[model samples]
Target: MKGMDVCFSGLLTRAKHLADAGENRSDLAFSLQESAFSMLVEVAERAMAHCDKKELLLGGGVACSKILQEKCRIMCEERGAQMFVPANEFLVDNAAMIAWQGVLEKRKANKNYDEWQPNPQWRTDEVKVDWR
Candidate 1:
């Protein structure tokens, strides 16, 4: 949720309200964590179904969270899919993945490369796929 603007702000506001109401901090924190993990699992499962995938791989720093790993494990089990997580040492921040995206975009560039710029809102189909 770090880069997720709306959800991150909403979660912080909720946490503040709960704290002001004298809710047990540990319980409040776990509840928030669980909610976030559950949302991630729900979305992952949807993607798995959409792609007819039988394996789920949890990557990046968030995969180091034991709670999230457990939730994803249970979800994968219920779907009769396998879930895989790399060792904690490999779950470092996503800088490598981010950089690899630059490599990919470079491969997609051509004579019109000057038109290149990151466009988060751009449609996937809008990309020329000759690089494939």
Candidate 2:
């Protein structure tokens, strides 16, 4: 929930309030790490409400967490949506992957080859290396 706008902790506090008001419900989800369970659940639920539940894909570094994966599975099942998570290699980061992505985007941008100096701290918006 680091970048998430919704506060799960606040939701938990509201759930506690509901419990105090005699509406004892235990449907809760949480993660101590930067996992995508909450976002996946939210997206799945929203999609299920509109379309057929068969087109949700979750793939990233956060997708491998046990709590996240299992919770996403349960949320998808409950919402009648399908959740797809690829293997761990697809989730983890590697420099080869970075180079591959750079090559692909470079090709699409019609970038011409030139002497490119690598920066240790390159921000996408800051650097405008027009190879073409």
Candidate 3:
């Protein structure tokens, strides 16, 4: 997410060029996956160091990749930390997390999503936390 934000469109363009140059699709995919996984691990390591933490928990759909899991595990091992990746089924589905957030909002009577508007300029610490 650093250094020009590394857009996915750029990766797609690169893959297109590679495909045009007669590169095999599997190799192109492998290259893109490696590039993405490396960037993710780099950011994760920086965050772990900043927080002085020794544990890394990966989630989301990409977390289901065995290559990404192996890369994260290696990074954690080299840093003497622990990397926790749940089963593939748990990695991709976030319905429970969304439901938990709903529960929290319900507890605080903050269920009116229609009243909310997007504010891209707002910073994390500046946001209101009435639901808490």
Q: Give me candidate 3's TM-score against the actual structure.
A: 0.65
| Residue lDDT tens for model 1, 27-97 | 98888887777778888888899899999999989899998999999999999999999999988997887
Tens-place lDDT per residue, model 3, 1-132, is 553233466787889998999999999998988888898898889889989999999999789988999999999999999999888777676778768965776678755777656554455466565785
TM-scores for every predicted model: 0.64, 0.41, 0.65
TM-score between model 2 and native: 0.41
Better structure of 1 and 2 per lDDT: 1
lDDT of each: 0.79, 0.62, 0.81
- lDDT for model 3 comes to 0.81
lDDT of 1: 0.79
Q: What ordering of candidates by lDDT runs from best to worst? A: 3, 1, 2
Task: Rank the models by TM-score, top first.
Answer: 3, 1, 2
Q: What's the C-alpha lDDT at position 37 in model 3?
A: 86
Best of the candidates, lDDT: 3
